[model samples]
Target: MLGGISIWQLLIVLGIIILIFGTKKLRNVGGDLGGAVKGFKKAMNEDEKGNDKSTDDPQARVSHDDEGTTYDVKAERKAEEQDERK
Candidate 1:
């Protein structure tokens, strides 16, 4: 009785799916899906709150401390070295 499929037909399909995948695997998949949805909702709520705060304070700037950070830099090769390699 759902979109041209009978309740019995739905039950049969459900049974076949359960038989193919088993119950424990299905349960784990459902749990993972639920957790992902919950995390997504939490992130969305936090983003909305952040947007509100940013709107309220236009002059706010995000700053980071770079006290002891070192970047990997390669030494520059001279034109003579480049010509030798070529």
Candidate 2:
């Protein structure tokens, strides 16, 4: 019934996939996928915290380049001053 594929046809395809991969391998793959998603969520949360902190600090200015690289304005100015002195 789904795009011309009946429930029985869907079950057959599912069975074939299970037989090819086995239950254990499928379980491991699922666990790995879940872990990857968890890690991605954690990284996103940390990035948001970092952006918030940067905005809170008056001396810290964040800028993005064409390549999506972030720059800290205060840090860059300090580095430039050191280079000038050298």
Candidate 3:
């Protein structure tokens, strides 16, 4: 009997699993389970950081379009219009 469940019950459940999936397949299952655990840990870490808004320390700066560009929006539009006319 299992320490909790009866030994027979545990054996039956294990047998069912082995029948449904061979041992080799079950071995690969561990890798998938480990990956899921790792992903969950990463998501939790991200959430913890997401809740802290006071931290403005960015590891890298991602600039949007024209973020660092010197071109003025109005001048660019006017230049495009002039080019179209030509």
> lDDT of all predictions, in order shown?
0.84, 0.89, 0.85
Task: Rank candidates, lDDT, best first.
Answer: 2, 3, 1
Enumerate residue pairs that collide in model 2.
Answer: none
What 10-residue stretch in candidate 3 is worst by lDDT?
A: 54-63
Candidate 3: regions farther than 4 A off: 1-5, 54-86
- Candidates 2 and 3 compared: the better one by lDDT is 2
Task: Please give, for residues 1-86, the per-residue lDDT of candidate 1 as tens digits.
Answer: 46899989999999999999999999999999999999999999998888878846645754456757664344335655778899
**Candidate 2 lDDT, tens digit per residue, 1-86?**
67899999999998999999999999999999999999999999998887878767765655444676667999999999999999
lDDT of 3: 0.85
Estimate the TM-score of every prediction: 0.63, 0.57, 0.49
- Stretches of candidate 1 exceeding 4 Å from the true structure: 55-86
Candidate 2 lDDT score relative to the true structure: 0.89
Q: Work out how many backbone clashes candidate 2 has.
A: 0
Candidate 3 accuracy as TM-score:
0.49
